[model samples]
Target: MAARRPVDDTTPHGTTPHGTGYGALLRTPHAWTFLLPALVARLPYAMLSLGIVLLVHDTTGSYGLAGAVAAAAAVSQALVGPQTGRLADRHGQAAVLVPTVVVHACAVAALIVLAHSGAPDWTLFLAAAPAGAAVPQVGAMVRARWVHRLAERPALLNTAFAFESVTDEFTFVIGPMLATGTATLVNPSAGLAAEAALTLLGGLAFAARRDTAPAPTGPAAPGVRRASALASPGVRLLAVAFLGLGTVFGTLQVSITAFAEDAGSGGLSGLVYGLFATGSMVAGVLYGLVPWRSSARRRMVVCYALLVLGCSTLWAMPNLAALTVAGLFCGLAIAPTLITGFTLVETLVAAGAKTEAFTWLTGSIGLGLALGSTAAGQLIDRSGAPLGFTVALAGSGLGLVALVTMRRLLLAPAPAHRTVARGGAVREEAAPAARRG
Candidate 1:
């Protein structure tokens, strides 16, 4: 067995301290209860893109049509995902997830039936939209639960966020493999069917973990209103940054596939891409162990800068061997950046809007993926496989520029708590350190 690392209680700024390590964080009451189900509920997200592509491609025999159908789902999901989160924040996660999971199951089932029946392409898009839109914001809700569970304990919150990112990386890496292999090996519809099955089962189970859910937001006093998470400039900035990461994700998927096919090793694409997630998971585990002094906002900037530098090397990688190694190095910055961004967002929004804020960041990534994949696909067709990487690099460059230029906007200015009292008058109180993360 590995030796236990001692927790330092004297460390300032929630860096390294008592029970902040991964082992300790997992030991939190009922941690596995909520986390395992949340992880299962979220695995479908990783499978959906490839699952859709496979299921649709098989039925239509037109990759272009299949892609368009998938894109519609992705775009609608991006637009509607945050709204589910907003509702969850107000009504509690169970209230939102129960109904959302039902809707998602029906929508996905309808989509599968429509495709298999040779239904018109428009009908497929119609089913796809709702199917995508109803995807539970389980990941965001999980983070909100962590925030609530670890409140007044920032170090553990940091560890929890890092662990979340690591799991996300793991899911994405594994989800596609499960989806694709199941589709090809069993039947085209099997992957999507399995995805729906997992979501239904896991989402309901997660919803039942109400004890860990955040307190629902109650009605504001008459003549007073709560702020939407998007109203915060910092939240918007982070959303755009996540969008940048999404673009990189989209670009890489297509570019790697194309590169592998060109090299007569298409079968190796998944394993090659898996390397990227491997690097991210490794970095995320290590990230949670260190005790950093800088604010999450500063860490976001630095990690993103590293991301941009990493992306710069992708376009010039000469072969699969070099690209695979470069991909690993480039991915090293991703989880750290993602973990820092989530930590920062936790500080930027109010308790009532935290889930919404997290959803916006996640939804932005979905939108970015759609945009990036579309652009990269066209570029790859017109030029070559290597050109697809340019989209990833460009997205990173633009996002870095935006991040650096608007770094000030990334800080949280809203008071940590708001009081509505005495004839609906509201008073705001700031907890600067807590708000700064």
Candidate 2:
């Protein structure tokens, strides 16, 4: 049966509707047209950090320089992403994506050229900035489209958010393998080159599928009180929490590598990382399946507390096997925390600002990862791998503090406004962000 788009905005934040599965979300018309390309575009994001590190390291032969270049790009992306999302809201996604994709491809080419030419280190920063900035926010845009499609069906939206998080973790698990494998089997530059190619092709394909894109929301009307997505207190809180979440990711990658190397099992780093992602993937699938009674506001705090608890043991693990087990435990809390955060987003901001709001969280993660990696590297250089794990634990602990103290912010009402469909048609109703499950 085809999924119906009724007015279910009154439904609470948790997944309460029993029969709506991810299949139901996909069974509708034109779903695959936009979805597959979005997934394709997003894969490069997971690849870029590693790919850039590999290529730059090959050229510079200095891990410090290579990591610095990658960090510059990630920070550049984090700063520019929400701006792109806001522009997409004012104009159409396709209008913004065409130029963004073109710039991204050119920038990547320039970065590769600079690295191979042994240009001054400053030159790499120049190319890396725009390459990261112009990388399209396909993941956030796709989520906005999902909001436009299922604004009335909150249960299905819950499943959709869960599915997207799982897809993200899937890419994270696969992207590093593809990048490192290509560099090993082919050439160092090949990994980043493949990443650029995917962005160019998949971004264009996604942009061309304009029929499914969220309609351009030109400006907020007089009745709409919010001036920006970040104006919402809840949105800001989630962004902060997600920034902490990113540190876990950034810290783990470097720390795990150090751990494995210390134990004479350096080859197992990828396997350990994959094990962590697998735990999140399994948890995400199960999270979407269960119908819950708690509101999303309460859920965020609980899930984050669990994440913090899981991270507390990372600094104390005695060996590679123990560290991997600790990572797996920490991973189990990740997807659920992310799923709840995005769900809260759907209810926290008005339709006009959906994409921008989502980008804020996504970009925060990027920022956290860059900062966390730098911090962990410094700590490990001064001390050891065990000290490096403290970065993840400390970051998450700070977020938990906010989650517990300022959770009332999560209950702020979702600003009221209907989503404008293509050709200026209104397609949704006002929704309250602070509702019970």
lDDT of 1 by residue, 1-437 (tens): 12323222223233454567888798888889999999899989877766776687679764445556766777788899998898888888999999999999999999999999999989999998998899899999999998888776767888888899999999878877788678767987988999999999999999999999988885566766667788878888998899899888877766776687689985566677778878888999899898776667778889999988998988899999999999999989999999988887777666788899999989988887777766776677678788888998899888888899998876554333444456777664433322210
TM-score for model 2?
A: 0.87
Clash count per candidate? 0, 0
Per-residue error at 182 for model 1, in Å? 1.2
- Assess each prediction's global lDDT (C-alpha) against the native: 0.81, 0.81
- Taking every candidate in turn, the Cα RMSD to the unseen true structure, in Å, is 6.9, 6.9
Candidate 1: C-alpha lDDT: 0.81
Please write out the lDDT profile of model 2 over residues 300-406, one tens digit for every residue. Answer: 88899999999899999999999889888889999999998998877777677889989999998888877777787668766988998899999999989988998
